[model samples]
Target chain A: MLWTVMPLEAVLDGSDSYEPEYFDVPWNDGGRLIVEKLNMDSARVVRLISGNANDYLDASIQPGTIIQYAPKNQASKQ
Target chain B: MTLSPRQRRSSSARRVRTTPHPALQEQPKTHTQEKEKGQDVLQNIQQLGQTNIPQQLSENGIHTITIIGQIEGHITLPPQNKTTKYEHIIPQLVAIEQNPKIQGLLVILNTVGGDVEAGLAIAEMIDTLTKPSVTLVLGGGHSIGVPIAVSSDYSFITETATMTIHPIRLTGLVIGVPQTYEYLDKMQDRVIKFVTSHSRITKEKFRQVMFCTNQLARDIGTVMVGKDAVDDGLIDEVGGLGQAIAKLQSLIKARESKGGSTDALDSDAP
Candidate 1:
């Protein structure tokens, strides 16, 4: 039950789809999230950001947050 | 004092009467003298091993600059961290560039990356060297290390070496705003531009791998192995120190043949 923030672009691109079984809550309005408080042994509260290319976003991802991704798109193969 | 045969025969009476000065007297060699010589040799070895003093190697024209651990910038990292300070590196680069005796520069990198600006500055210095230079990437050349590795005229990586191509990461307090995003975007562009311009990789290909989300488990970047790096046109070849030195020698030879002075010449001659 590890929770991670999925960027708005990932969700909008269809690479990461929201699922009821994985997350405890529905998608938030913001494109980014700010962690308000952190318990060394337990939990945290985060705020979300609205998805936009111009949105000021911190690119760094936390260590344990596994951002889920769909299989590679056939058109975007490297 | 004992007089020689010629002195004794010619001026025996005078020599026998006069007392020799202590400075002119010869002391007999003893076991302690031999032991002292041995101790001096050991002390010389100890001096060469310890005490970060720079000793000139036997007149070799090749200068080796190692970029080990983290490349530190303006801020001081914790004492426990192994950091290659930019202040130290910048001067060495200048010396290597200015010194005529240094005909070639060999840069060895095994960094996990550090400040983006520091790494780029080092890379730029290496890229702009007039002397032939070669880069050998040992261990891991991750993050900003990638740019330094490719900055040399030729680059090599061991079979087990790896390079991580990821977007620029910022630490400390970061403001979340469109301007921040724009700043990050421009910084990313700078890295991509430098890498693409120096290496064989296309900008599109570099960006693709840089932004790839499938490679790292929790991170959004790609880790390329030795031969994979060469295949992807990031590094020149998969080789170790021996190959790297050979390539450097060849480059130096080629440069010399093309009218570049292999030996230091007096530019100040009137």
Candidate 2:
């Protein structure tokens, strides 16, 4: 349920057609970082899903920081 | 034969020249690298309007969490809408509670409020924290925001700030059944209970203001300005950032004096 001053129609406008492209990449020490894909190799960190409190303190993985991921084929080549 | 003084000095100078001067040799390399770094900084400034984004200070005992725009929950609103996701906030609250260095929390709210469950989750987290906390409402803290605004140890609203209290309602996919009404009523009761318990407002007074008809146009609720909220016992005081920080600091100090001394005395005793 929504409890807000904004009209329901205005708040949900374009919501039906809007689908975000988010990826879960393996992150530091077995934690996972959810990122919104910006391109083929790079994504912006959306949030970290982790049980460790220290994981949240890592500046590099903080939300809004951009990260680069290697494709499976590229990793195999290396 | 022994050389003259002048001849000895000339021989030493010639020996020094034979060995390369490292500083002179590295000057050109350092210059190019500095130029490249300067270009990167300039590019960063041009792109992000900031040369270096400031990171949160870990040493500071007080931490701030801002609830702005919408409190997004299960359904992700469109990208155009600015949202404060619960996934991000819940973990941060956990970190704040777990981290030893953090002694106080300051919540700054400027929200229209959204997602009844998400907002309550945040409020519940703040309310249960052992450390002292203070909340400051800058703009409109309406609807679900009311519960959050009062969840802190002390709540403040700027003289110009306002809070709207309204009953909760289902947005989409509402079935025409009595059960639907009951569900909404249950949700509304949860919010009322939270607000009434947290602040000085009573259930009867809160419901009266919530269902007040003449205050808002096209709505059945009251729009409480800063002083009005304090007068109604919804908020503690009318102040801004400075006062909020001062209040949080005092609360933290009070807690430490009360809790810290007993621990010290017990540990020191035989």
Candidate 3:
């Protein structure tokens, strides 16, 4: 249910626009997932909707479903 | 005998001409310009220093993909274990293929090998990428890592590096029956086919190394060190980072001259 919207630069070419906001989806167990392992089968999903940080994705994501996202690109800011 | 005043003056002038004042012997303007430019280049490189994850080398139109530690697959390894998760890499590869800025890929591998299917998945991705790629194996690229090392357009290994070619291994619950053996055999054949077709080594030679019983003290495989890998045609060359970078640059240059975007070649690819 947690979908990571990849930065445009990574998913596309020639566009320099920045995404202002990204919806954060909370885990069902309330346990934070490791960002590195977010791409494993347990963390992968075909598609997802980004919602507010406090919004629960339990209803949207079926049990045993996994979702993953690309980490926000912070290199440009530095 | 004391020389005359004229003679002394002339000799002193000759000495001055022969060895000019150290301060006046400043290096040529171009040399100083180059030195300053070198500093600028060094600064740019330093600014792009190694991050926790892979990044693009925009100037060279190349991106680096580091496959370190173990290739973790579906299972989540413990936090203490150093692993390169396949899911993380698959998306990155797709992005690299889509992004026009990325003209080539440089794969830096130093893995001990993990899940066989995961390793092969990453390897297959590299093999199919249209952008030219080069793999540099440092430390050890063992077991399933062998297929990955040879999957690139060109491969390199450091002087002290080693590679172990062994048959596929399975852990956890195994039925230990004839059907299990058949499944393992089919998977092993897939790996063998990929490695032999992509690399200079023949299927027979690779199988010889993979099934060798005498190489390891208590294992079934052959260990190739540096040039030994090149000799066996498993790796393209016995080289390190510099060589790997140079090869990638050359490939990028070649691709540009041929008027083919990295992906264009992929359409006509084998």
Q: What TM-score would candidate 2 get against the native?
A: 0.78
Off by over 4 Å in 2: A40-42, A57-62, A65-78, B1-56, B260-270
lDDT of 3 by residue, A1-78 (tens): 000111212322221221111123333344222111121111211112222222111212211122223234369659
Q: Candidate 1 — which residues are off by over 4 angstroms? A: A1-78, B1-56, B262-270
Specify the highest-lDDT model's number: 2
**Model 2, range A1-78, lDDT digits (tens) per residue?**
778999888887876655454555555566766655554544455667788876675544555454444343436657
Kindly give the number of clashing pairs for every candidate: 6, 0, 2
Each model's DockQ score: 0.01, 0.18, 0.02
RMSD of 2: 17.5
Candidate order by lDDT, decreasing, is 2, 3, 1
Give candidate 2's whole-model lDDT: 0.74
- How well does candidate 3 reproduce the true complex, by DockQ? 0.02
lDDT of 1 by residue, B175-243 (tens): 988898898888888888999999999999999998899998868889999999999999999999999
The alpha-carbon lDDT assigned to residue B79 of candidate 1 equals: 26
